[model samples]
Target: MLIAQVTDIHLGFDPDNPAEFNRKRLDQVLRHLNEIRPRPDMLLVTGDIVDRGDAESYRRLSVALGQVNFPVWPCLGNHDQRENFAKWFPEIPFVDGFCQYEVEAGPLRLLVLDTLDEGRHGGAFCEVRAAWLNARLAEQTDRPTVIVMHHPPVEVGIEWMNTDPAEPWVDVFRQCIKGKSQIISVICGHLHRAITCQWEGTTIAICPSTAPQVALDLTPIDAEAPDNRSMIIADPPAFALHWWNGSQLVTHFDNADEHVMLAKFDKGMQPLVRSLMKERPGAE
Candidate 1:
């Protein structure tokens, strides 16, 4: 099974204009995913669907999402309003006032989580939500499960955007999934950059945003001082592809823009390709 993911679209960044930059970037990515060979089985929009949570923005978002042909599953982000989102995306059920649910994808069980603490910059998982997750985890201890959420728990050293390790919510989340061997990976977004780390004996894969990307500077920033620094950049829009090959869930990050071809499989490269294939363990 192949899963395509696009995050932090921020479609209403320029609500007045019909041709907004973020919207264009999202369209570029959706077009590529829609036309790519072996089309993705589903698309996961990992939060921040709009810059401001508004009914008009959601309406526009719904129109933009119509370009894709695959199933789209979205969670909530700090920038999202649950009331407005529920109105626009009625298909997604909100359980107990939380946008959380489970999706059966081929052989894998996807636990889509709600990490949005509206009006706050960070994530939140209350005891109620944690209890729900615990119950779900207990249901099938042997099934390969993937937790999909908006915020990644680890701090990535981008001082301004890092998730505080001492936060109460992080502790709750840690306790909920600790020692769960069935969880193979946790797919997340909201960092606006592609990052992976080993946490709680599983992999946390963060997909880059379709909107502008955060600058890759790790230097500490002083709030009082106004030092000119690159905070955000218009890097080419990005996405992630997760391939489930029975035992492992391999993830790949990519940009949605066109790239210059440096190599091709032609008569000159045919011999190299053949030789590489023959070196595989079970080459025919």
Candidate 2:
């Protein structure tokens, strides 16, 4: 299964302008996904769908998403308003007022969790959400599963954007799937940058944002000190492709901009490609 992901699409950043930058970035990524061979089975929009949780923005988002040819599953992010999201995306059902659900793909299962704690810039996985996840995990013990959410429980070293390891919700989330081998990976998007780490026995892959990316600065930051370091940059819009090769999920990241091809499967490169292919055990 090939799954495409785009996140942190802070659409409606400029409410007055019809042609917002975020929307264009999102469209570019979507168009690329559509044009790619072996089209993605689905697209996961991992939250921060809009700048402000407004009905108009959600409505506009609905229109923007129509460009995609694949199915889309969106989770709640810190900047999202559940009610407004429901109003526009009535197709995405909510369970007991939370945007949490389970999707059964051909050979894999997707458990979508809601971590949007309104009024706070961080994530939250309350008892109710934890219970929901635990129950779902209990239902299927053999199938490979992927947890999709907006806020990643693991800290990615971006001080201002990191998820504190000591957070209570992180503990609760950890306990729910600490030893569940069924979970192949946890896919997330929040930091506006691509990150991967092994957390609680599973891999967590953070997809890059379709909007501007967060600057990659690992320097320690002091809130009181005014260091004018770059926090965000207008890098090319990016997306992640998760390839499930029957046994494991492999993730690849790339920007929407077309790359200048340095090599192709032409006569000039045929021998190189053949030589590489012949390296395999069974290759003739």
Clashes within 3 Å, all models in order: 0, 0
**RMSD of each candidate relative to the true structure:** 0.8, 0.7
Q: For residues 130-216, write the lDDT of model 2, one tens digit per residue.
A: 999999999999999999999999988889899999999999999999999999999999999989999999999999999999999
lDDT of 1 by residue, 1-284 (tens): 99999999998989999889998999999999999878999999999989899988999999989889989999988899999999999999788899999998999999999999999989999999999999999999999999999999999999989999999999999999999999999999999999999999999999999999999989998999978999999999999999999899999999988989999999999999999999999998
Poorly placed runs, candidate 1 (over 4 Å)? none
Backbone clash pairs for candidate 1 read none
Residue runs of model 2 more than 4 Å from their true location after superposition? none
- Residue 15, model 2: lDDT of 87
